[model samples]
Target chain A: MVSLSDVPLTKDRFQTARAAHLWLVLLLVSVSVTSLAVGASGTSLWGAFAKILSGQSLSQMEKVVLWDIRAPRLLLGISVGAALAVAGAVMQGLFRNPLADPGLVGVSAGAGLGAISAIVLGSTLPIGIVALAGNALIPVAAFFGGWLSTIVLYRVATRGGRTSVATMLLAGIALGALAGALSGILVYIADDRQLRDLTFWGLGSLAGATWGKVAVAAPIILLSILGAFTLGRGLNGLALGEVTAHHIGIPVQRMKNLSILVVAAATGAAVAVSGGIGFIGIVVPHLLRLWTGPDHRTLLINAALLGASLLLLADVISRVIIAPAELPIGIVTAVLGAPVFLWILLRRRGMVDL
Target chain B: MLIANDITVQLGHRTILSNVNFNAQPGTVTAIVGPNGSGKTTLLRALSGDVDYSGQVLLNGCDTRQLKSWELAAERAVLPQASTLAFPFTVIEVVRIGLQSGTSGETDSVAMQALNLVGLPHYANRFFQELSGGEQQRVQLARVLAQVWDPVLDGTPRWLLLDEPVASLDIGHQLQIMDIARNFAHAGGGVITVMHDLNLTALYADSVAVLAHGSVLAHDSPMQVMTDAILSKAYECSVKVNTPPPSGFTYLLPHSAGLATVSQDSL
Candidate 1:
């Protein structure tokens, strides 16, 4: 199927395996510094490095910029990017549709509505009341909203007890439309600031990444990400078609459910932290597949790496594009991701499906 | 042992398989043949736990319905009529999936041996989806061959349920598959394959199940089921059978008055 360069390096080819592993590790290693240092703020790379290494209390301005702002935002970008990429890769496996997205599966939209409802209802409740309501209100609403759409989609898509791509896609489309309409109606009743906030959040930004946001996102992202890496074998079995998957003792139904739950929750958590970032879920697995083939073990980890790198780079570009104000991360990804996606598509016209 | 007792399949308001009964002991090939829409794949899918059906399938004295997913997989493996994998995997990688729930699954030597059985050992490293239809079929066979397991307990029996596995292969490959199926049965593994080729059935099938309109019209040896009256009725074609000069199997021919009855293909 491929020439010399196209032939995938096998695991036994220790040199080739080492080369690819080293390259991906290098990519991952390379981006950790970029995430920490590249930003629009006053914390220079040397300053942040010196502050941490020197073990000295920073000036008030430096402390505020580093801890309160840049640190959390960078962490959020990497986490959310990783979450979307992993969720997207999972969805691609779940439905065997390369084009499926975390949002299209209704996870993102449901979580968006849930978090927005919390924000909208927060104004009416006092600070004294907010503490009582916020803890129970936010994640519950998000989980319930996301889970409801997922359950409905699963039922409609699975016919005579088997899940098919055509049915999954159709059901996803129907539920997505219903969620979009309900979200629009919610936005209709909002006040001026709430309206602006909803619009801006829907366009998506990592602007609200505080320590509190990380506190909420960290555990969910970590657990789902771990589960994804562990379940790589089951996902690869599934891509072989359901009968073969079941014949291989894969517990196809259980794997399907696990995939949906893990993806929806991870996507919901990411949406809760960083609003609705679009296109990342739809494209990352595809690019990952191009780079590493469809073996899920490599695809899952590579997805996390490339996704983090892609979004971190997108964040950097967003910051520098407008000197004083940053563009929405969603806009930046679409502008950048679209060209790469189209380039892949155009170059492969009538040549390869991926 | 494999048993399907009065299996009935209903889709929507219509019945697809109506009270079909069949069973097979170890070391036998129970060839299931039927016209299109006669529920061959449906029956095979039911056997592999791919569908919810009424009635019972017992394997090695255990009810299949009660078996866990992994248990059923280890005991009975089914090759559907056609499997076109949507993902990109090397032929070896695809075969390795057959070891999902089996012991000795990680041994590439065993997998390569299985591929060698099907004359595809050299293609083990080739991309599965890159192969032609015929090659892919052989590769899938190798996958199943790698999946041989001890799920029948320390001394229990193993079974293979295949649905039209050689539908795309050429004549020589088809004969090789027939031989392989025969070998599996002769070695005390139950082999049930759905085949459309009557000549192939005559050549290799130890027993044949003629399914017509969701019901078994006949269940007997190929010599009994391939009679001119039943063949003409089931296949809707005129046919003639010719005995070999020595003692080979009968060869089928088109029924025509001008051709000599003894000439198998003179028509």
Candidate 2:
């Protein structure tokens, strides 16, 4: 029989948590450097470092390739990765279930529908609205779509102040089906060019990332990530259940509202910019929970770092595997993350009821 | 002092508690006892400000509904009947959740002390889910105990509102937990527990409130309230009260209806 006294002490756990965070940070930096170097242009990371260290100027083409094309894509990948991961962590905490994710909650489907609608119907819409949205129209529409679905799902799942996780999961599946149906109708009507755009967006890619798109997405993602940090304590209290959390002086209702809003914003922005990147949101937080336990304070931060690094590493693989032609980032993440997720489930087979 | 005055709780269309008046003074253990489905838990929940009710709950003369969330947390801590945690939280981490109200002190020391008081000093490091049911209940009790570790704060006594705190504990741990409650009351804190064990209630609670069908049937000292007539009527069984030689404590032994009919036939 396993006894209570066999567990590790608080001091030791804290030390391990700190060490885990430090390692993730170090890994992120190394992966980030590799991400900046590995591209079709063949600008070596060490060569760039040497040039910058010696105060020497790079050729115009090298400067353009490194600073303009690669930098924006890397930044976008980092932002989108961190956003999705943090959104996943917050969603899991809010629902009080490890299996909850943005995709499971229909945010990705809603965003996909929004992007597809924009791709297929933008020219036919009122010129005033198109002009107003300008170059950021697709991302804006996707954000609104994700946010609206979240609100609808939240309203449907919650009755008289209590949010039921089971109901939310069921409702999310229904909503996803509805959104997928709408997206299919839009895809069916699209011309060949529009069809290609829809296929690429559905698969998710950072190849289209530019400084302007990054600029449009960065603020919403950053603010929501910042907002998630304040929720750690409330989420911790909520682990005991809602009534207990309320008894412990957490404003449970307000916390729930804020958590939902932040998750929606972060996920909406990420899906808007990078399209529906899978696995990072769900898998990163689950893996970290295993290593550091389920303390959300550390979990959120580590998820962000690990999520960013993993996406960057995946982006590098997407870039180099086919050289001039890149694989869609969503496919790369799914290819890499699916096996690891399966391993996690297999290892914890009997322990989790899921 | 904690006073719940004329409280009535309605869950949907069903009225769970009606016009129930109860009070617990500082440095006293007040037990609320009833049969299953007799509104014991509901009344306790209303008193703890965890449910919507029609009447007023005042803690130290301040209406509980008027108090802010953190303010109420500072004044009292509640040990719910059952807590389900999704993640594998260590015992100490679970206890520290009680400190999230920003109560100041050495959190680790306070959590350890509460764990020690519950006779699980070495269990601080264990995963709460890994513990047995009774042990989980004690860990929850420790969480609440750590929340209001100080008996008296700013000249106002703190309160512990427990619901079926010992329902899952074995005899030894039950006594240990009851002693912990008794010690808290002895140290000038107040405790209002919903209990089913009549003998334990008689032994530990200074006062007993017998509730039936959403109303307070009787509220008085244990000896006054634990009479044979009241116990038999409230519990729907024949009960005999026994007084041992030296202790002068009350004990109630319930006779089942089936056994009573058999014995009556034999006689």
Candidate 3:
């Protein structure tokens, strides 16, 4: 019953896109500054900046806290946030559905299962892998686990060059449950040391983020993000449907394959490092879509920036809310994101069939 | 020119179109008409290269399958029966999707002109999902029109392969759409439409192909094919084709089996 005339066509879409980009960039800078400033210790960002600018030598503790700890954690937070949001945007475009999310597709659970196995069974792993991984075994295993689950999910959902979104969703749910059960068994067998590691990782936090982890994760995340940006036009064509997308000169099958690969690489790298931060993948792109009119060209870029900002803001709150003891970043995102998601659903109640 | 020879489409064990030979020449409107299950849409799909068939489909004397997807897109545009979009895209954004193929500069202006041709010039910025069914159909038609806005490019005529383009439209919009198709043909482009309204087909189509049971029953001028026996046999019902002496326009009147008894009881 919605009337076409009632929807105004006054805004210039390009101008709106430009404005959204600018606003999100500013917001990201401000929130990142805030994230680096506020932490367990009361080191003001200005104090760190002033100390560096004045050519004064900082104490070993101050250098360790600022350069070694906060900087890397902030960098990891931004990379993981941007990766999850971009993956979500690409997955939504590939599935041609607004509700599609990286977590819903079993990527997070697979990563969790991989991380748990690495934690509980590290001693049994081969000597070569242990030497190569050194301290980074957990994230590397998690990345491979995520990639494996995605390959399985994609194979189960695709047949004769067509991917059924419904089948993908159902199979993802089943796979997630299976991964969760395996992770539970691993947790049951773990000693006290491994038990603590599993508990903290299960809750999802950036407390363990380090420069070494960022070095391992940033390249894959950045490459996948760049690859995803190139798919904007093809995804736009796909919004019309597969046949029309083909008619409009998009290589439909190739686009689908590339989208799936990009999403897996990006989300796998992110979950490997961040330990399954929740809701940013689903919430950031959906929220931006309401403002940007669902054009993937602009939506993908804005989602990256805004996703980074929101996750940093959430990280800041998680650090400060409990002071010396940090709350899990996943819990913070769910608390902040769940209500916004419900509001979106309620606003679109009559328009879309859930 | 678009040509299909011995096109046979089999979905699993059932054949949807069997050895269906069809030709659509440049500068002409060809209508494919049939009953509900007569495979008119399937025949159009085969001609558009949207389905795999056993026979050859030639576009401008080249085998259609040999052409790359972008090359085929540059030559023809298809308006499907229905398109469902999951996102809330603006009308112009949907139409701009057509600009993905060839070097069509000034995409916004081209899309606007296509929308103007469909009599919805002001709908460029509106959300596509908010439109009514008929409006949505027009938006799709506009998208198709935008794809082949230039009826002829470098002396080669483009084609519009439309499947039930006017199915959801009212009478006024139906004529408007038919006129749009006719104008494209007059401008030296090919138009092949699957139609159910025989009267509209008679008025607008340069030639008519009547299909029944996955086979072509008749293919000729409307005057030659719109006959009592041919239609009645194809439709499996009593039909009368009438033409007045001066106007020379055909009107078809179908007789319902139980109408006489119902009318008598009411009287």
Candidate 4:
């Protein structure tokens, strides 16, 4: 039996989430600074900033190392990291499962296939197409590829407005294998120089990050992230299921369409630049949801912050752990993320009925 | 007034609700009662715009098709038979989700007040998934209650469209929920619920719509709709309706219960 008692109601987690926002911003800034300062060239960010603040010219070594190399890599890292994490959070919300990551669900693999096709087959394309694409051919193709795969996965996994976790993951495996086989064929046909590029790119790295790649990836990633922010309320409503969401005034169909497009563009741009970096999407959002409540209004933004910081930190480890030669950032993330994924599965095994 | 004219819901070749014309006014507890697969829930869904039915549903004198979803939300709140949350949310947070679209005057304490009305104010901080089935149902009812907190706003009545709102509760809690629905209607709100318990429906409903084979078999006062002939025909069983002394409200006992008692007496 329940009694009607006058107990003080606990407020929603908005304040705590807001306070955490402040801390996450601070953490991202510090991680960004640390990433800039810790590369192999050892360009001291403090010296560069201090000199710029005092109106002094940068040394030639500092200028080349900091501006030409590390700066673009850092920006790319932040964009890709935020894109992956935010995409993960949005995908989980859309699918209504905590384990639904874009990378794990073959979106990144589809994008990877698109990027490899561009790299291996770009020279054979007509001059007009090449001229039209300029530097963005890879990212644009990857966007379509990722978009196609997301739609396929969504259609295959969801029926009658209900998503089955088992079907989604299994479909992801099939899609990943299909993408991998196609990428392998492209790798087999590559010329000697393209082969060298494909070997490193397939492993996933921030090593080849350049100003040109950053210019192509950053805008698409940022735009998609902005689109994802508008989906917080809709996603929250969707957490109660589609019918209930519509009853609460959310445009369920439009929001779901926007979510699919946002995820594809973000993931396509990221995979075009950074290869198949896995686990940041799954790990960052899962951690944030555990830290605060699973309120997407805060969760999406916090996921961006933590994703940026975590990826930058991983990039730092990749650079320093091997010194002159670096481990692929993908290797670092998988080593760290796969265990967390397993732990989450085990913890939720009895609770979620998944 | 809520009106559904020529509401026909067809799933594949089978028609779920066929040309059903039903109307409910403000300030009344209207119950939709039927046997299994009799389209009770489908009629509710059609009226709430959750299903695609070839009919026009008018809520408060406006065509539902022309009204935006938010406009419809402001006019009514729906309670599905069961609600499952993908992510963990506290009880109050879930309630406030309704308040986001609701045109409530006192927004701050209405969620808590709704919880209190459902007698679960103390569970405000508990995780929704952690609650029992009945408790979770009440929490959803509280959320629906918070959506249309005021029965009538600006002289126009709001609606609480519930599907099997008390199907999961025990006897006492079923009474408590029926009382809440009754109170909501008494305060000038319209309550239309799909109910399984005919006795509870007879006790609480001002009007009852009886459905059999995807058609409204009867729609009138509970006394008219809850008769033995209608019950026996609709349910395909012999139901003996009784007007117990002092209260005189109709209660039903399946005629098979008497036969089972006779066999037990011989044994």
Candidate 5:
């Protein structure tokens, strides 16, 4: 109901913002399509987009490339990107720590470990069985893993239903490290092909994305993100800090639990699909914070959009930079993101926090 | 009326407040004064039902513990010593928090009125954390005022608990805050505040409770509890009660005494 990042686009005309946001969303979509169409094959960007939308029959190779190759991959990138970003925004609001991301409760490493176990075991089974086991079972395991960490962290930090940001951060760091170690152990046990698969997967790419894969990740991402949007009001209440939140009857514990679940499910799903892409959650919210203030309504939704755009743009660059030989989107994001972080740091030099 | 009964609080196995009992009529400004770690804040927390306590608190003849959180919230508001806002809420948004205790009915209007009462309506769109400390205190007061100013609960008034809210304010804002507290009490609200300024306590308190070592040392009218002996012993310093010319109203002024005995009767 209340969003901590609810900076109404116009301090006056709040309702007008949806139209603008839609326009921006559409503009980004066009950009995404253009990036995909103008690939190494040198297809005309508008002709490819027109052909894709108009139901014009493609040649066998074109059909395979467009529908099979680019389409599902783009959707997966967009959806997972949005999920990771929104999850990040919510995490920052809940913890009151700007540096915190969706993976704070070991979600990333947990997901990575779950995915790795699926890969190692999948090698022993049929390819379909392994793909099913890895894609379906891994996210569920990752979800529970994230949920367990959140509960433990909540208990360690909370007294009388009020959670401490500092304690949660410390707990998150410890848990994340532990999960990372387990991921390492899992990686160490893989065979040659398994190791190759894990290596490239660990680096994170959209190459494996099919519509079926998008379908695997989409429901969890969509539902959790929508749920988080509903918490815009509650998140704003949370930003007031716990005592006042309780004073205003926010049901602080319940809100924290709900936020954790949403964060876990959303981040878990993203990690299950995207591998351990770091800092989308951290950077998106930080940038949005500067633009939208601390209100979550604006912050949450903007983070989702900006993250989609950022990931789409990142994926496009990853695809085009190496031509047919693509770089992982994860590597590209970190390469691009670190410089922005540095710029913010330098601009605010001597100021305590950016 | 607001009543704090048999409230006992322990922290890390040591009793911070033990069996504290007190009551104040509606429309009265009650001041709680004590030395450091005397459990004044703990008592306020207990009364506000912000933490666990051994006993019950009653507001307007209803048990605070038994009332649903939303039910209890409509009848009282507490402003702690420090409220941290991590979000960049505008002044209006900060005050709007007080309105959530009840229906959102006419709250924007009332919030504006509360801000206007604090002489801050012009800053409605300004960021809350950007304001000066005094201004922030005023905005916080405005928010609490909106909470207690309920139309449906008009017949029976609510309570206000302020925990040293004026500590960071300057002399002008301090007096302004004291005036606001006095006004709120005079308007049939039960008001309790912990204050260190003896002069302020004398100025606004209808009844004063002095706590020492987590116990009530004295509870009575200002003149009764604020004698030279109690003042000197409470602060462990020599003090002179000053009554300035023209008004003849008394104020507390600390003094240094070296190996000499003095009497109030001499003054």
Candidate 6:
């Protein structure tokens, strides 16, 4: 019985992916525990557990702090981080370049535009339409915005199935600048409360995590992340180019469509809830690829785990850095990640295929 | 048998290939030869169903378009002229990508065997991006070979569609790759290759399809097709076809139009 497992290459790759899954799962679990325990509120998960074990009813403060505040934040963080990282891996695979991160490619900015518009221009909408859309408006608008930008960028940067890296980067910059300008105009007109909310949201923080936001973002992010995992084999084949991927039995067009949708949905959901959290998308995938070679099957899953853990760790830092005056999580990630991105670019100067 | 009937391809306002017909029986090495832009690769792309064309390709009595991608994959494998990896995958990993959708049902050592066939088994652990152009070409060939490991499965012969498989190779590797194609045909599979080397084509190809100006000039045995007149006209140069006495192998020498008679006499 000559099974595929007998092949050395298959065996090595299987072992690597399995090992990555094991380690990354452990990392995620530990990070989740740490994130639950450490906060400026000083209501530790250990304290609550100790009281529960000693058979005492929990106080209102602990319950509110732990369940109401930290739990939803943790879940929301995991979903956003995983969504961003997996979306990054998928976009890189689709563009066939390491630098094709959602944040860098203007998809995040476009989604941010959708979200900002929903917030600033939301009250002006027709009463019937606003009532019908209700809370789903922002995420839905963000999804459409992300989808539109991705399509435009793809059309502008790719011709005859070949994507030009220079063109893609240039188009991304142009799109980002345009979206930023529009966002500036909206920011200028916002009232005081809305302005405060807009400013914090634009900086990207997890302070507003609520069960309602979790309910909205979690299912979409989960479904899209799982969907992205199914594209592992197709993306691996696509690394050889679209025609060759088709020749090797991958439905290239279908995979491309699914990838774009998956990236758009995940990024849109994450952006709607977490605001413009950048670098998790680009940095997580790049670090994971360096650790384990770029097999999308393992890379997507590993990126999710590592991305979640790293974001939670960053969230912990954001909570303590100013101690009760939380620096936005986005600042922490950029401070840590931008240097790594530059180092990778410098180390791989001529090898980037651009 | 692989047959392409009335295959025509148009890109924008220009016709790349026009009403071309070609066929290859199993157990033979067929070659497509032409000038730089004579649509050799385009014809192969049409046959492989990699491009849209206004014609039909039948593989072993079944229309290629009618078959699903996996079904077509089970019947034939294609080797592109060159391939670039998007990420740094190991040689073995790149080769393993071939096994994902293959009809060769989970064979134990097929990937390794294919690598060995391409003389790259030892290079399995090396990153594919670090290899030279010729080595990378062979690794891709190994991948293609691994896809259709059993050339004949379930009494139906599979096919190898190679587009300039040895274009980046040295002379030794070129001969090595040609031999692999020859062996595949000898083992009851079909081999259709687009070749740039006329002498190598004459030495190895059982049948030659000469293409020029988006049309087939001739599809015949090498002995019948490698004439000086056909060669010169197809290439628009003064090409002399010679068969040396001892080995009975065909060769060609290309020269300027004015030097044709003088060069022939000297030869």
Candidate with maximal TM-score: 2
Question: lDDT tens digits, residues B1-267, model 5?
Answer: 888888888887899989888888878899999888888898888888777888878888998878766676688888888877775667887887656622255877888788877778778778787898778988988888788875226589778889997888888878888898888888778899998888888888999998888878888988788877786677667766666789856697555474224554465
RMSD of 1: 4.0
Candidate 5, true inter-chain contacts retained: 0.38
Candidate 5 chain A worst ten-residue window by lDDT: A1-10
| Better lDDT candidate (4, 5) | 4
Give TM per candidate.
Answer: 0.89, 0.95, 0.94, 0.93, 0.87, 0.93
lDDT for B225 in candidate 2 is 93
Superior by TM-score: candidate 1 or candidate 3: 3
After superposing candidate 5, which stretches have Cα over 4 Å from the reference? Answer: A1-20, A31-63, A121-137, A352-354, B67-72, B90-92, B101-109, B121-127, B149-152, B229-248, B264-267
Give per-residue CA lDDT, model 4, range A1-354, as digits (tens).
356555554555766787889999999999988988997777799999999999999999999899889999999999999999999999899889887878777888899888888889999999999999987887777777787888898899877765555687799889988998999999999999999877777778888788999988999999999999999988989899889988988878778879878988899888888888889999999888878888898999999999999999999999999888899999999999899989988888899635
Order of candidates by DockQ, top first? 4, 2, 6, 3, 1, 5
| Stretch of 10 with least lDDT, candidate 3 chain A | A1-10
Grade the docking of candidate 5. acceptable
Residues B1-267 of candidate 1: C-alpha lDDT, one tens digit per residue = 888898999888989899988888778888888778878788887777777789998888888888887887777777777886766677877877777532243566677677778887667667787899899988888888677633234566677888897899899999999898888878778888888887888888899888877888888988788787676666655566566779768668655654535454554
lDDT measured at residue B52 in model 4 versus the true structure, 0 to 100: 82
lDDT for residue B265 in candidate 3, whole number 0-100: 62
Alpha-carbon runs more than 4 Å astray in model 6: A1-14, A126-137, A151-174, A352-354, B101-108, B255-259, B263-267
Give one digit per residue, the lDDT tens place, for model 2 in A187-300.
989999999988898889999888988998999999999999889888989899988998898888888888999988999999998898999988999989878888887888
1 or 4, greater by lDDT:
4
Give the poorly placed runs of model 4, Cα more than 4 Å off: A1-12, A53-55, A131-134, A151-174, B101-106, B257-267
lDDT of 4 by residue, B1-267 (tens): 999999999998999999999999899999999999999999999999888889899999998989888788889999999788988888878888866732244664898789888988888888899999999999999988988889999999999999999888999899999999999999999999999998888899999999989999999999887887898789887676788889888887655767745644775
lDDT of each: 0.76, 0.88, 0.87, 0.88, 0.76, 0.88
The fraction of correct interface contacts reproduced by each prediction comes to: 0.56, 0.71, 0.64, 0.67, 0.38, 0.60
